[model samples]
Target: MKRMIYSMAIPLSIALSANAQDTIPPDKLYGELFVDVQMNRIFPDGKTFVDCTAKRSPAAIVEDYTKIKKAPTADFSLKKFVEDNFDLPLAPSDNYKTDKNADVQTHIKQLWQVLKRNPDKTVAGSTLLPLPNSYIVPGGRFREVYYWDSYFTMLGLEASGETAMIENLVNNFSWLLSQYGHVPNGNRTYYLSRSQPPFFSLMLDLLAKKSGDKVYAEYQRPLQSEYDYWMDKTAPTKHVVKMPNGDVLNRYYDQYETPRQESYREDVELGAKANEAVKKARYRSLRSAAESGWDFSTRWFADGKNISTIETTNFLPVDLNCLLYHLEITLSKSYKATGDLLRANLYTQIAEKRKTAINKYLFNAADGWYYDYNISGKALSNSMTIAGITPFYFALAPKERIEKAAGIVEKKFLKPGGVVTTLKNSGQQWDAPNGWAPLEWMAIKGLEQYGKNDLAKEIAKRWIDLNVKVYKATGKMMEKYNVENIDATAGGGEYPSQDGFGWTNGVLMQLMKEYPTP
Candidate 1:
C-alpha cells in the first residue's frame, strides 16, 4: 500500500489531490490480521471487521497485535482480539416500526427519513469516507450511499417532491469525483477499487430536469472526469477493451486480484481448491461482477449456473455500454449548452462511434436483442438478460430493433408479477423469478420511448401491483422481488433481500404517479 498520512483537519480535496491521505483498503490496513480474522470466521460477515473503527491509532493497534500474537499467550481468541482492538460496525436500527395501515406511498415517504443519513464527520480509522452533503442510503446492511442505486432512489425523491435531496445526492457524487477522480461503489475505503456503474451523468440529468440545463454546466468537469476514468486508453485491460473489429468499448474490472474485503470469506472458500493463478482469476471475476452491480449473477458465469465459474471481466456488458453512450450524449449536450460547440461536436462524434460499435458488436440479429460481447472469446455472450433492453432504454436502438426487443421482453422475460431479470433460473438473485425496481423502471421507460405505451404500462402496472402487494403483506419495500412467485420471499444471493430499499421506493413512487390504481 502507498504510504501517506491522514488528518481530519485537512480539506478532503486537498488531502486527496496532494496525496496526503492513503486510501489503502481495509485488508492492507490490518495486514495478516485482516486475513486471519476473515479466514477463521471471526465475524459471520467479512464486512464486519472491515467496517469497524480502530479504537486506537492503526500503527499502535498493529504494533500491539504483532506483540500479542508473538507472545506465549494461552487461549488466544481471535474474536476477542478483534473486539478489543476495534469498535464494531453498527447494524442498521430495527427501531423503525411499520405502519401497515398506511397507504404504500405514505409508507414510502416516511421511510425517506428512516433511510436518510446526515453529513458525516471523518473518523480516523473508519472505512466510511465522509460525504459533504446529506444523502440517502439503500438501507438495512448498506448504510453508505451507493452509486447506481442512488439514481433509482432519486426518482422516488423527485416524485416525493424532495428535489433538495436529489441535489444533495448529485453534489455528494461530484465531490467524490473531485476527490478520488471517480466515484467508488460506495463511500468506503474498501470500495475504492471499483465503481458500481457510471450513473453520475444520469444523476446530473435528474437534477437538471428540476433545476434546469445550468445543472449540467455546473457539473461539466466531473462528467468529463467520469468518462475519462472508464475510457482510459492508458490502461486498456483495466476498463477498456478493443474489439476484434477494432472498436473500443468498456468492461467491468477491478485492479485488485484479492478477495473482496466485504465478502472475503465466501470468495476464499469458493476458490480454496483452485491453484494460485485460478484463485486470483476467480477473485477478479467476483470483484468485476460486483462492479456490474449484479454480484454473483449468472449473467457473469461461464457455465450459466455456478458463481464459481464467473468470467465477468471477459465480457463487455450491454447495459454498461448503453450507460456510457448516454454519458457521452449528456456531455455533448452539456457542452453545447455552455456554448462550447467544438467539444460538444467532438463528444457527439464519440457517441456516434460508440453507437455504431454497440449495434455492430452487441446486437445479435438472430435474437433481435442486445447481448454482452465476449472480448476474450471473440463472440457474443448469447446470455439473454433484462440488460438486453438497455439500448432501447437509452433510445439508441433502431426503430425496427425496438419492436423486436419489446416483443422478446413481453413474451420471454415477462412473468406473472413483472419482468424476471433473466430467462435462466440460475438460482442467482439477478436471474429468473427476481425482478429489481431499477430494471423495471428501465424497461418501462425504454418501451415508452419507442411509443410502446401498452407494453410499458403493462410492465409498470404489474411491477407496481407486485410492490404494493409486498408492501401490504410485509409493510416494507424490498431490494428485489420474486416476480415468478410473489407469495415467496426473494432469494439467491450471499445476503438476504434488504428492506428500506432506496430504488424500490423510488421506482414504485415514479410508476405509481404514471399508472395509478383504478
Candidate 2:
C-alpha cells in the first residue's frame, strides 16, 4: 500500500571512448525516437496528440491507427491496454516484397523508403533511419514492439555505433515503466499477462553507463515493481500456478493462454504434435509471464520437453536463474547509484546469497555445469541451454568453471552467426541452429568479463562475419540467422519468422557501432 519515488542521477558525462557524440546531457540524450505505434495506443479525436496510455484496438486489416477504435477512460480492456501501451507504428512489417525476397531483408527494408538512408536521432541516443509514412502509417510492426526481439535489436544498435540509440531505448523502456508496471510482450490483443527475460535492469545498466545517465534510479521503483510482479508470483500457490510439482508455482509464470500445442503450431507442427507426455505437461504447466513469442514457450524448456509449463520443473535453468541473479545485482548497483548504501548492501547480500544458493543447490558437480533442478533439488538430466555464460557478467563463476562452460559453447552451442538458442536442435528453436543476437553479445561480454577476450573476440568475429556475409548476399539483416549454414536464410517463429525484427535491427546497429567486425 505504499508508493515510493526514486530520483534519477544524471551524470554530466560518461566516458564512452568508443563512439561519436562526445557529450550530451541526460535530458537531451535520445531514448525513444518518434514511433507510430498506431494500433497500439489510443487518443480521442478532439486531442491533437495521442495518449500512449490510451487503450485502443486494431482497425480493419491494418488500417491507419488513427482510424482504430479507442476506448474511453473508463472502458480500457486488457486487450486495448496491451495494444496501445507498446505499439510500433509505421514499421514495414512486410519486409519482403515476395517470398523470394526473404533472404534479402534488412532493417532498412522495413522502414519508410523515404527515410531509409536519412538519419535521425532516436530517444535512445542513436541516429536511426526514420522511415517514411511517419503519420501516414505502414504495413507491419504490430508485434515487434512487445517481444524478446528488441533486447537483441538493441545489441545490434550497439554493434553499429549507436550507443545513443541504446540510451534512448533504455529511457523509453524506463518511461514505459513509469507509465506501466511492466512492458508487455507486444502491442496486441494477446500479450497482456507476461514479460520476456527481466533484462530491463540489464539494459538499464548498459544505458546508465553509456549515457552516464543515472536517470536509471528514477526507474528503480517501477523496475522493482515489475520485478516484484514476476518474483512475487513464485510464492507458493495451488490454483493452477506454474510449477513442476503442480503444488508450487515458481516465480516466473502467471497463467496459460492457448492450450499447449495450439500456440506453437508451426514449431510443434514440424515435429510430433503434442504427445501424451507433452499433453500431460501442458495441462499440468502454468506459464510464466509471456515474453516475446506465444505458447507455453521454450524460454523455460530444458532439453526440449517444453519445461515452460511446470512452474519450477526447470526450476534451476542456468540461464533463467543467471538472468535473475543479474537482475538482483543490477538492483543492488542501482541502489548504490542513488546513494542508498544500506539498501544496496542488503540487495547485494541477497543476490550473493542467491548466487551461492544456486551454485550450491543447482550446480551439478558431476555434470560440471548448471542445470534446471527438480523440487527435490536434483538437476534435470539434459543438454538444454539455459544461458550458462551470463554468470561471468556477475563474477559468479569460478575461472576454471567458466572455461569449462565456455568450452561447451565452442563444442556444441556456438553457431557461426552466434550461439544457437540451445543444444537440443529439437526444432524447439530455443534449442538450436537458430542463432540469436542477444546471446551473441551475452557470450561475447561474458567471455570478456572473464578475461576470455581472445575467445570472446573469436565468437564475435564469427558472428560479425556471418552478418556481413549475409548482408552482402541478401542486402539485409533478419531476426535470426542459420548458423549451420551462414549463407542460408534463417527460419522464424511466430508469423513467418519475420525480418525487421526490432531487436535484431537494434542489436546489429549497436554492435556494428561498437564491436565492429574488424
Candidate 3:
C-alpha cells in the first residue's frame, strides 16, 4: 500500500459506544437536520448490540453507531456520543439544537426512513424531505443520492453513529462503477459534467475494511470505464487523422460559457498586460478562463450547458493527471487482485509513461513549479496557481523540490486560513484571495506527506474553524471563503457568488472531524 501521511490520523474524540436502529418520527424532527445526521456511521471497535430508536416507528431513526468494544483499552456508547457531541437529550434548539427541542435527532430519524427504502444507494445529507413544489423539481431530481459529497457529508452523519450508511455509500460508488464508467460528481444536473474530488479509491479502502470483501473482478469493469473516460475516451479528437505521438487531448470543462453572462476571467487576467499589438489576439486566445480557474463564469459561454469548472483546461489537468496516476495504480491493483498479471502490468506501464510525460512537460526546474502545457505546445508557466503543487500528490517530488514548492505556498499562496485560489487575486472568485475545498484538501494532505505537519494542521484547522464560525453566526455553509483576507468576502470571478455551496459544506464537515483538537 502507498504510504499516506494524512490518512485517518485524527483521534476519535467521540467514538460511538452504543446505538440502535429504531423508528423515526417525521412530525417531531426537522426534515433537513434529520437527513444530515444519518449520512454516515462510526463505531467502537469491538462491542455488543442495543438496537434502539429516536422518534416513532415506520420511519428509520438510528439510536447507535456500533456495539460496545469489549476490548482492553477503551469503551463508548453511541447514544452517549450523540448526547455529548450534538447536545441531544436537552430541550428545544435555536435552529436544530438538541436541548432546545430542535429535534435534529428526530429529523435524522425521518431522513433515514427514506434511505432504508433504497438499499443500493447511500444516504445523503441536508435532507430536503417533503420538498415544496415551489422550486418545482422532479422526485428523483429533488433528493439527490450524491457520491462525492456522501463521504465528507458522512463525517457529520457519523456523529449520530451510523456506520451502515457509509457502507451504503460504498455500495453506491460500486453501483456507479457497475453502471457508468465512473462516478458522477453529484446527483444533480449542475454537477453532471464532472466528478467531485477523486475520493473513490479512499472510499473503497474504507468500505473494504468494513465489508471485508475485496471483490476485484466485480469492480474492475467500472474502474476501467472511468479510466477510459477521463484518460482516453473524452479527450478531444482535434484531428481528422491520427497523430504519431498516439495521444488524444481534450478541453477541460468550463461553466461560464453561458452567453447570458459570459466573463472570460482567465483571458481578462492573462491578457491584462498584453502588448497593444496582441490586444485582439489575447481576446481571441483566452475567450474565458475556462481551463484554469473561473468557478461561475463557464456557464455563460456554453448556452447554459453543463460545464464543471475551468478544470485541467477543458482536458488533462496537472492535479487531475496526478489523481489519475493514483487511480490507474488502484485499478492495476484491482487487476492484480483479480489474478490478471498481464493487465496489471499494462496499467503499470501506462502509469510510468504518464509520470515520465508529466516530468518532461509539466516540470519547470528553472522556476521551481509545475505547469500545464497546452496541447498547442504552450506551457502555462507564468501564473502561480495551486495547480503547480499538484505534483506532490503523485509522490513525484524529492525533498528539495517539495521544500521549494512549500516556500512558494507559504510566501505566495498560503493564507491565514488555507491556500489561496490563485496568486493573482485578480478579484476573480477563482483567483487569488479566495480558497476552495478541493485545493485545501489537496495541499493539506500533500504537505503532510512531506513532513510539513505544522503548516498542514494550521491550514486545515483554520478552514474548519472558519466554517464553524460562519455556520454558528449565519446558519450557512458557504461555497468558498476569502482565505486571503479574513474579514473581506472572496474576490474575483463573476456575480456575488452563492455561499451555501454543497461541496464546501461536505469538505468542511470532513475536515472538522479529521482534525479534532488533540
What TM-score would each prediction reach against the true structure?
0.94, 0.65, 0.60
Instruction: List the global CA lDDT of all models.
Output: 0.85, 0.49, 0.48
Candidate with better TM-score, 1 vs 3: 1
Task: Indicate which candidate wins on TM-score.
Answer: 1
For model 1, what is the error of residue 447's alpha carbon versus the real structure, in angstroms, after optimal superposition?
0.8
> What stretches of model 2 exceed 4 Å from their correct place?
1-144, 158-168, 178-180, 233-251, 257-314, 492-494, 513-518
Candidate 3, residue 343: lDDT: 90
- What tens digits encode model 2's per-residue C-alpha lDDT throughout 44-110? 2101112121222222112332333342355545344335443323444444443334432344334
Per-residue lDDT tens digits of candidate 3, residues 81-185? 444433222111212322233232333333333333243222221111111111111111123444544555454345445556555555555554433334544
Clash count per candidate: 0, 67, 58
Looking at candidate 1, what is the lDDT of residue 5? 18
